[model samples]
Target: MGRGARETVLGTLGKATILQIPPELQDLTRRFGEAVWKRDTEDPQRKLVLLKYLDGNYTNYMQERTRFHKSSFSLEILNTSRQERQLYEFIVSKGPEEKVWQIQLEVYEPVSDPSIQILGWALVNDSCTITLNCTAERGDNVSYSWGSWDTSTSGLCSHNGSLLYLSYPLQNTSIACACTASNPISSRVVTFNSSECSYEQRGKFPRTEHLVLLVVVPIVAVIIITGVFTAAHLAMPIAKQEHLPLAEDSAVHTIYSQVQRVESPDKEPTTVYASVMMPTA
Candidate 1:
């Protein structure tokens, strides 16, 4: 038969075999070719070409199209939505022999900034604890890490999962902190001011100072009041007495009476004398 006639027959046979393919299989095949072709446009020199087999025997056709076969097939998917599992079938002798293969294309977006929250903290102690949670709208095998960034240094602490617990000293006001979310495909980082997670170092005087004031002030006040009462008690006189005597002498008589002053334990006592006279009848 002539070459043209042989090609016509082969084409007819190939079409009939394709018509017999299941709808699902046909869809799979079409999607595979489309994905490969889209990849080819970006790099025409690395086009993917499938082998054309002869009669249902691999031995007969294996060597015939060695030069026509592509080195390998690769698809570059820019968009994650476009990634999918693809099927391709290689037919020999118009359908008597066939081989099927699949290509799995996975495209994932980079992780976005993680959500951060302060669980609790102690400012006076200069310690803070925070939680970093990372998530992606479309990604798999995501991971998280925590770190501190300052003018002096940047250090990272690794954690295996999406959530990370970070506890660090908030010693410097200039330091900043961040969480990094990553996947096998890509990574992203989000930063925050350290002050956001830290407590205001309890001002100059903390709760301890207030507590000291509460305990010390009353004691001091009691001491001052006691001192004042003791001083007043010591300054006042204990007692006072006055006496007058009458004598029956014809002439005037003078008698001296001694007045004694009581002394405090802390002071010396004082004394005074008064003269008394009696007129006789």
Candidate 2:
């Protein structure tokens, strides 16, 4: 099956018909889905059941299409690759979150050498959200295989045909979505890395580099402020060491002197004087 918006139904295509489907196509979700999708297609599943499931998927697809294009468009699946990986190729065109079905479904003839381009992204804020559109340059029907190159961070990334989301939103990470576009005739591969789009990324938390600035910048500011304060404090003395008012600031702040008098009786004034300064404090 092709990658639907949420559920990547390994779409077991039965056959295509142009007849008017009953409004009861909704009923097929339970009864019709249980019959065909329950197991891999046997005798290629029931034709009527698959058609009902297709209608449900197409209904969901149309809702998305109506948002961007009010006009009608065409989609055709080359029924050949359904067994290549027992998989299906979503025929998509340009735009963001382009419908996995892109347009209504039809069985197309096999074409060759499909060139692919990963186009615009549609982003939103949640855990993580980004949509990558993969379009075939030449062939419209080809399988798309998406994967993560980094085995260590593989679990963090989730992808469908064109949609990519990360389990963790704010962190340092390099995520890649590669689509191996192949058909019965030839195959080609194209890839895009989220890291490459820092210049173009959108959303609440597009990159983790912002987180680094949030944490590191304030610490550096505090260190600089403290250093400046300490320098300014040292630049001006709290008080001169020679002018300390507290005696406890130093062990010695007292001095003793002795004076000798030689002439005692005659003048009562003959005395020798010597000047001494208390050790600079």
Candidate 3:
């Protein structure tokens, strides 16, 4: 009827122990009481369920322990009537107490899948093979399987264990490598791109450029060799010519002049000098 009456009846009922309150309903009543009275008593108070139903519906209540602070309580209804279908939730420290009344089951979220890293790479023949290492990020502990790329062509490879395989034909391509992780609640996928691998890069050499360089190198070598041989042959004659002395007699004869003397001799005979005799006794 009212708060005072309800408390009195509860006290009397407790003393007689005549009413057969089911263990579950009794726990609910106790939680309800704590949530109410604690709100009326303290600065910061605890909260509890105020009402519950099997169908999806809920009501909430709040009571302030002090003028400035309050404790709150809520009740949520799951739509399903199935007894087996339970919702899991976390409660502040009093798990055992809350479980008895609320019937709130504990549930876990699905774990995230495992991811891989390329530790090393090797080129076999013309094809490239990658070595992978992996780690799992999970809610609950899980194991992993690694495998080669599947027919579906999803960037991911099937997993047998952490060891997986990927084969790329000797060509240029962006290949996808994937790792899958699963747990009871959920599964996740992680992929490593081929480009991330150190040796995964395919280097290309131009066929035309290679041919051009090959042809040019020998031609240059021949030209250099021919030039060296010609210089060696010419140097011998030049050295011999440098060692020979110049003729001095040939130079004097080149400068001398020859005279025809007939007329010129007559003119020269006309001029004679007189000599004076000195007295001797």
Please count the clashing residue pairs in each candidate, in the order shown: 0, 3, 9
Per-residue alpha-carbon lDDT of candidate 2 for residues 198-232, written as tens digits (9 for 90 to 100): 43355444345666888899999999999999988
RMSD of each: 24.2, 20.9, 21.5
Model 3: per-residue Cα lDDT over 1-281, one tens digit each? 21222111111111111112134443454444432211111222544333332222222332111111122233222222222123222122233443232233223345565778755555667666766776675544455655436455453466567676665654635566666665554567777765654343433322345657878999999999999999999898889898966554433222333443455754763443444443332
| CA lDDT, every model vs. true structure | 0.45, 0.41, 0.44
lDDT-better candidate, 2 vs 3:
3
Cα lDDT tens digits, model 1, 57-129, are: 1121212322222222222222224212223223212133322333323334445556665433334366655
Clash count in backbone of candidate 3: 9
Per TM-score, the best of the predicted structures is: 1
Q: Cα deviation of 40 in candidate 2 (Å)?
A: 32
Which wins on TM-score, candidate 1 or candidate 3? 1
